[model samples]
Target: MTRNLLSILPVLALCLWLCTAASSRLVKRSDDLDPLEAVVSQLSQTVAGLQAEIAALKSSKADNAVLLALQTQVRSLQTITAEHKVAFLARVDVDVAANAPIPFHAVDFNVGNAYDPLSGIFTAPHSGVYLLSTQIFPQFAGDVLVDLYKNGGIIIRMRVFDSTSPTSESTSITDHANAGDKYWVQVNVGGHIYAGAHSFFSVTIVFPDS
Candidate 1:
């Protein structure tokens, strides 16, 4: 009877040890699963943060592109504005008989009566410094006086005497003339100033820096 009791006690102890080992394995599995779940949650949060940063970068890139386009447009507009400015040159000629007064009245060009007919009057075509010159051909020995007037005032007066054939005199007038500024010239006195058909005086207006 004693031997049988010992054998039953050994079998009971072995069954209790197997049950304790199974319980420890289940607890360790549960602890490992908790840590894995926490890792997966942190990885999901990090992915979301990266996605937000990518979106912000895309927005900044778009803003920079828009600014660059605007700058290019501004430069183009400035170039066009510079090209739109108007600049031009004009030439005019007036012929007169020697000793016979040749009148370039301001009223003829619709400028106004700002000049006297007896004193040569020439209307400015545009605002600029004009180089005025006169060429005269006389049949006999004579003298020629060329006068320039501006704003109803005498600006310069030039004279040529003892001229038998074609004679020329030139003078520069620095004047800020509008589109309708008045100017003129006249021959004061000359001997036998008018004889041949070719014997006459001519005036020319030129722009020095056209």
Candidate 2:
């Protein structure tokens, strides 16, 4: 665009000079004045046409600059959204001791590497609103207590008990957590949780903190 403008400037200046000279000669010359008058008229029209075209090009350049800026902003937003994404699904494959974080060793997926199957803990990678959930059942089933912990503080708890068969219970919570805050599902009071698909835990980011 800049090169085009530079190239056009010289032509525009020459046209203005020719138009002015023609107009002056039209006034001074009486013999063959009709030819001179025609030339002046043509030069005047060409100068006007060039001016309008330059104005239009300037307007188009401004519009293009604005569009490019908007596209850059959108790409930046998309990168942030992708970086803030967090989610995990894990399940306990062995009994967990009471008063300990359930080591959900069987992982279905952990998108952002926030959830550690080794420790059964999810450390937030970004500050955001999150959804945390779990389901658990005692293998022998006298009674069991499952607690959802956030940074070692109990957020909620569930109790499951059955005399004849295993009883399962599920719980979920949604709350805001800062980056590096921890979350885990734990056995609070009663003994071991049943191994297998009956016990599961999950964490997901609902939205990123702006």
Candidate 3:
């Protein structure tokens, strides 16, 4: 009976040791699982934050592109507006019989009594540089005086003289009259009297070909 009891005691002790070892292993596994879960949660949060930042950056870039396009369109519109303003003026040519009374040509601007038998008038259609010229027949030797007037006031006066019968005189007005500006030319008879049949003259406004 004593031997049986001692053998049972040793078997009971071995069972107790095995139970303790199993409990320790279960605790260790639980601690490791908790840490792993925390790490995964932190990684997920970081990924989400990065995605939000990327979305914001894309939105900002799109807005800037739209604004730049609008500015370019505005500049183009301004350029077109300026071009339309310059097309209102028309260039023309006039012919006058030499030694004849000054012929009247109607224009947009007002004309005063600034005419000589040999002098003629031209009106500005718009404000810009104008090249004034006259061609005369060679039979008459005389000088021509050109006067530019604005609002009934004289702005410039120039003189050209040639002894040869056929002569041409030219001048340029950098800041020419605006629309309705008036201009006229005076023929200086000098020594020769102008015979209505023998003298002929013409005036032209020079322009670049479009």
Separate clash counts for every candidate: 6, 0, 4
Query: All candidates' TM-scores?
Result: 0.35, 0.65, 0.33
Better of 2 and 3 by TM-score: 2
Model 3 Cα lDDT, one tens digit per residue, 75-183: 9877744442321111112444433333433222322222222234455554555554322222346665544444455555545466656454444454444555655
Point to the candidate with the largest TM-score. Answer: 2
Model 2 stretches astray by more than 4 angstroms: 1-76
Clashing residue pairs, backbone N/CA/C < 3 A, model 3: 98-199, 98-200, 138-165, 138-166
Write down the RMSD of all candidates, one decimal each. 23.1, 5.3, 21.8
Best by lDDT: 2
Candidate 2 residue pairs that clash:
none
Poorest 10 consecutive residues by lDDT, candidate 3: 84-93
Q: Rate the local accuracy (lDDT) of all candidates.
A: 0.49, 0.85, 0.44
TM-score of 1: 0.35
Q: For model 3, what is the error of residue 157's alpha carbon versus the real structure, in angstroms, after optimal superposition?
A: 2.8
Q: Write the per-residue lDDT of candidate 1 for residues 83-130, one digit (tens) a residue.
A: 333222111224445443455322223222333444445555445454
Candidate 3 residue 89 C-alpha distance from true site, Å: 9.5
In model 1, which runs have C-alpha deviations exceeding 4 angstroms?
Answer: 1-121, 125-128, 163-166, 191-210
lDDT of 2 at 135: 92
Candidate 3 TM-score, true structure as reference: 0.33
